[model samples]
Target: MLKAKAIRIREPGGPEVLELGEVELSAPGPSQVLVEVAAAGLNRADCLQRRGFYPAPPGVPADVPGLEFAGLVESVGNEVSDWKPGDRVMGIVGGGSMTTRLVTEGAELMSVPAQLSLEEAAAVPEAFLTAYDAVVLQGGLRAGQTVLLHAVASGVGTAGIQIATAVGASSVGTSRSAHKLPRCTGLGLTHAVLVEDGRFADNVLAAVPNGADVILDTIGAAYLSQNIKVIAKQGRLIVIGLMGGVKAELALGALLAKRASIHGSVLRSRSSKEKAELTKSFIDQMLGKLESGELKPIVDEVMEMADVRSAHERMDSNETFGKLVLRW
Candidate 1:
């Protein structure tokens, strides 16, 4: 058995519940690899899990709350041949990534881009992967199309802007704060809407005229109706978070008239096989852009593993623009 320091939650309630302590880990199983974690990215889901709202998926360590990590390979199981000790990797997991070391299936890992630091790499897997899947694959965003993204300065929103730019699409983004809009312009945001009292649809429509071909929403119920109003014919609306409340009354008539589609996505609950497939797709599509600096991780802050509580507090306060990385 190997011993490592990890942030474990004694009982889910608040950021104060997170505790740093020693934990035991067994050797990797066949097809798995052991990684010496260098950094882990903080997500809104981590805050939700810490508050007892979102539980880790079955088979994940419920007490350990983290979704993405970047690290060096320490060991590999007998069945793993593609990766060996010393390989640099970054990837997403269901949980248990808030530790000094972790075991994950070799197929689930992505080789860290040569240009990125481990802290930068830690911010990529979750944000980029989620944005790519929603905007490109599911939303069927094509070149010259228009996309509107909520929470404009967020990790995923910044990623979407870059991805859309790389593919020759235009993006309009909305944020509650007017200050964040300026920062997003550097990421290729074509339009920035400052949402006041939940009014953004008019600005989005004004920017695009024909309406957005895709809407990537992090705020749920609060933005649903407005999203519907601003989406183009046959547009795809992908909801990946519920920063707002969950339940909302929908305008089915408008939805049908526009022939729009809405999808809800959560990466953590996906099966290992599904995650591996997405990771492979991401590598094929976005790795080159990442290497060439066309795409980059937008990190808001970095903290030590011992400062996990403060990290959570920052995210909870909604003051962060991009990812908050925790270095081990």
Candidate 2:
């Protein structure tokens, strides 16, 4: 067994409840790899987990809250042949990623692009995978199409903007912070809409006229009706987070008239096999862009792991323009 230092949630409450602690890890089983984590990305989901709203999936440490990590492979299980000690890797996990060491399936790992540092790589897996899976794979975004992304300065939103641009599609992004919109525009966002009082459908229409071919939404129920109003005929709306609210009346008439579809996605709750498939798809489709600098993780800041509480507070307050990476 190996001992690892990690951030633990003392209880269901605020950032003050977080503390540093130690956990034990067994040797990697066959097909698994042990990693020395360099850094981990801080997501809003981590904040939710700390507040007792999101629980880690079964088999993961319920008290440890992290969803993505970047690290150096320390050892590979006997049956694992694709990686060796010292290889730089990054990927998503169900939880328990904010630690000095972790064990996971080798198949889940992606090589850290030579163009990116480990801290930058820590911000890649979760945001890029979520955006690629939601925007390209499920949304079926095509060349000449337009995608409307809510929370446009978020990690996923920034990644979505670049993905849309890389695929020859245009992107219109929304944000309550006008200061952040210019960064999104510099990242290839074709249009920026400053949403005021949750009213953006008219502005979205004004930008695209015909409406968006795809809408990647993180603010769930609160934006449902407006999403329906802004969707183009046969548009696909992919909902990946419920930051706004969970319960709202759906406008069935508007949905039916537009012939649109809505998909709710969560990466952490997925089965290992399903996540591996998604990782493979992302690597095949998007990894080269990351390697070539065509697409990059837009990291808002990197902080020491000891400052995790502040990181969580920043995310909860919606002050970050992109991802926050925490390193031990």
Candidate 3:
């Protein structure tokens, strides 16, 4: 076993509870690869996990709170052949990715695009993978369709905008901060709505008279009613986060009239087999766009791994526009 420094939460509380500490690592098993992590990406989920509100899925380290990493392959199990020592890669994990090293299934790792640095690659996996899975796979976003993304300045929202554009769809996005809307236009956002007083239904309908064909909602209860208001007939709404709150009142009549569908998704709880399939699909469909610079990682800042508490503070403040990356 090797000893490595990592961000560990001693007790559930606040950002102050996170601290740098040592962890023991085990050798990779068959079908796994050991990676020397170069950087890790921060997510709002990390904050939820730190507060003990969201626990890591079974089999992942309960104390470590990271979901994505980019690094070089340190070693591979006897059965692995797709990657070798010195290969640069990035991927998502249930937990433990905040450490300096981790063991993950070989199939979960994707070769880092030649144009991106390890820090940039670290920001891609969770944000882009989650957005792609929700908007394309579940929401069935297609060419020429209109997609409405809540929290457009977030890591996943930024990725969703680019993904929709890459697939020939038009996108409309909303954020509490008005300034964030301009930053989204360059990513192919057709319309930007600055939500006021927790209301944006009228603006969304005004921007796309036909209404959004797909709605990628990150805010839960607070926006559920508005989402139902602006969704088009036969629209699909994919809820990927619950930052606002979990419980919400639904209008069954509105849902029935629109014939809309709502799907709640969480990436960290998926089975290993499901994650592998999603990873493969992402690599096949989105890797080329990343390589060609059509889709790029939006990194708001890169902090040292030791400053995990500060990272968490920034995310909690909702002041960050994109991914907050942590370098080891």
Candidate 4:
């Protein structure tokens, strides 16, 4: 086992409970690699974990909180032949990413784009992968189709906009902050809707009367009705987060009439094989774009991991336009 410094959640509560401490990391298994973590990205899920609303899955460190990291490969197990020491890689984990070192399956790692720093790379995996999986893969978004993206200024939101544009699909993004919409539009958003009172169907309809072919929603229950109202025929509503609330009455009649479908997706709880497959698919389809600057990681700010409390506070307050990345 290797002794490593990590961010430990002392108890379920606010950011105050988070503390930088030491933990033990087992040596890489036959198919694993040990990474010297340079940085990690903060996600809303991390906040939920800190509050005790979300717990790490079995086999993950229960007290550590982080979903993604970018770093250098320190060592690889004997059975790992693809990566060598010092390779720059980034990927998602179930937990324990906010640490000085991480041990993850070698197949789950993607090469960091040469143009991006590790800090910037830290912001990519969770956001881009989630958006790609929901908006493109599962949603089956095609060229000339339309996608509705909520929380346009968020990490996944920004990524969705770019991915939609890259695929020749139109994107209508919604945001609570008017100021953030302009930046989202600059990121290739076709239409911007300012959500009010948990409403956006009217504005989305005005922009695309046929309704959106794909709806990537982060806000749960609160947007269910509006989502149903604005879905096009055979539309796909991909729900990746439940920030608003968990329970809501579903408009089954309306959904049935449109012949649409809803999918609930989460990356953290997926099996290692599933994650590896997703990583491989993403690399094959999107890595070139990342390397060529066609797809970029939108980072709101980079801060020292020691100030993780402030990072969580800012995220909870919805003060960031994109990702909040932390480095050791």
Candidate 5:
């Protein structure tokens, strides 16, 4: 048995409940790869999981928690020829990432771009893949169009801005921070609106003047009604988070008048085949941006594996502008 250190919930409530301990890890299965985790990213989903609002997908151990990581391949299982020992990779999984070593789906792993550090690479998959699926796959963001992204300083938010730019689409990003607003602006976002200062609709519409061709939002029900007002004809609104609340009243007239569509996505709920497809698309379409330095992972805070509790605190308090990673 290999002893691996991990953070777990001992009855969830808050970050303080994240207990660190050593556990015995088993060897990889035929379709799995054992990775010595170099870094693991913290996400809003992590907080939800810690609060008992989320759990590992079926078949994953209920006690473990985490969704993504960057690491070296310690060993490859049979029939996994695309990777071998010593290879650096990043990938997403059901959970169990809060460990020194863990198992991952062999097919989900992607080669880390040469220019990226392991910790930075750890921050890549969940945010970027999620943003990619929303903006490109479902939202139909196109070149010469415009997009509005809420919580634009988040991991997925920042990723959305870079992706919008890479696809030749102009973007207006929103944040509560006047200070952190510049980071999104630095990514070539067409507009940076301070959400705390006022409503985002004005800034977003002012940038495009008509309305946003696409709205990539994580605010959920809080912005549901307002989103309907800002979306252009046949526009797309993709909601990926529900930080404010889960239910809202919608104006059916607005929907009929604009002919717009709303899409809600959760990456963890996807099937293995679906995940594989998304991973392939992201690698094929997004890797070049990383290689060209047009897209980069945003890492806000990094902590030692033992300090998982503190990492959770920073994320929960909204103290971070980008991804917070835990290094093993």
Candidate 6:
């Protein structure tokens, strides 16, 4: 048996609940690759899962608690191609990411953009791909269009700003802390606000004057009604997460008047087939932007796998800007 160190949910609760343990696993199955993980990205879903909110897929391990990783291939099962031992890559997984090694189907990966270090690539796949899908693919973002990103300093939010700029679109980002707003400015964010400072709608409207052509919101129900009021005619609003709460009341009148559309997406619950398609599409469409440094992943901190409890605290508290990584 091969044994690896992993972070597990001792029980659903706070940061204190994550336990560092050893787990046994079999070798990769056909069409799968075993990656020797260098680092794993901590996502909000990990926090949610740890809180007993996000359910584990059937047959998937319940304890392991991370969504994505970047590493070198250690082995490849039969029928795999486009990868071999020692290849550098980053990819998403159903779970079990915070470990020394992970098993992923062959189609779930892409070669890492050459210049990115494992440390940085840890921030790539989940946040960047999710942002790319929301801002570029689904929203049909085009040059001169305006985008509004809630949680400007977050991993997905920052990625949206850089990618929007890379695509020649403009972006406005909002954060709850005014102090964190400046950190996002260098990425070409047009306007940034502290939700505590004033009304986000007013700040957004003032910045664009014409209202947002696209809005990427994670705040969910909390911002649902307000987003409808400011979205431009024929605009697209893509909601990726609902940190605030899920249930929302809507004003259909405003939605009808503006001719805006709202979309909700969850990457984790999607089938393996859908995820493979998303990963490949992202590699094709977003690779150039990453290669040119037009789009970048922001990494706030990296800590030892042993310190996962503390890492979870920082993520759950939402004190940091960008991705938090755990190194093995």
For all candidates in order, the CA lDDT equals 0.93, 0.95, 0.94, 0.96, 0.87, 0.87
| Candidate 5 clashes between residue pairs 3 or more apart in a chain or in different chains | none
Number of backbone clashes in candidate 4 = 0
What is candidate 6's lDDT per residue for 36-98, written digit by digit as tens?
999999998899899999977865678898889999999999889878999998998888889
**TM-scores, each model vs. reference:** 0.98, 0.99, 0.99, 0.99, 0.96, 0.96
Give the lDDT ranking, best first. 4, 2, 3, 1, 6, 5
| lDDT-best of 1 and 5 | 1
lDDT of 4 by residue, 291-320 (tens): 999999999999999999999999999999
Q: Candidate 5's residue-wise lDDT over 67-95, tens digit each?
A: 89999999988978989999999998878
TM-score of 2: 0.99
Total clashing residue pairs per candidate? 0, 0, 0, 0, 0, 0
Worst 10 residues of 1 by lDDT: 5-14
- Segments in model 4 whose C-alpha atoms lie over 4 Å from true places: none
Candidate with the greatest lDDT versus the true structure:
4
On TM-score, who's better, 3 or 4? 4
**How high a TM-score does candidate 5 get?**
0.96
Candidate 5, lDDT over the whole model: 0.87
- In model 5, which regions exceed 4 Å deviation? 1-3
Residue 124 of model 4 has an lDDT of 99
**Model 3 agreement with the true structure over 7-124: per-residue lDDT tens digits:** 9999999999999888998899989999999999999889999999999989999999999999999999999999999999999999989999999999999999998999999999
User: What lDDT does candidate 4 reach at residue 89?
Assistant: 98
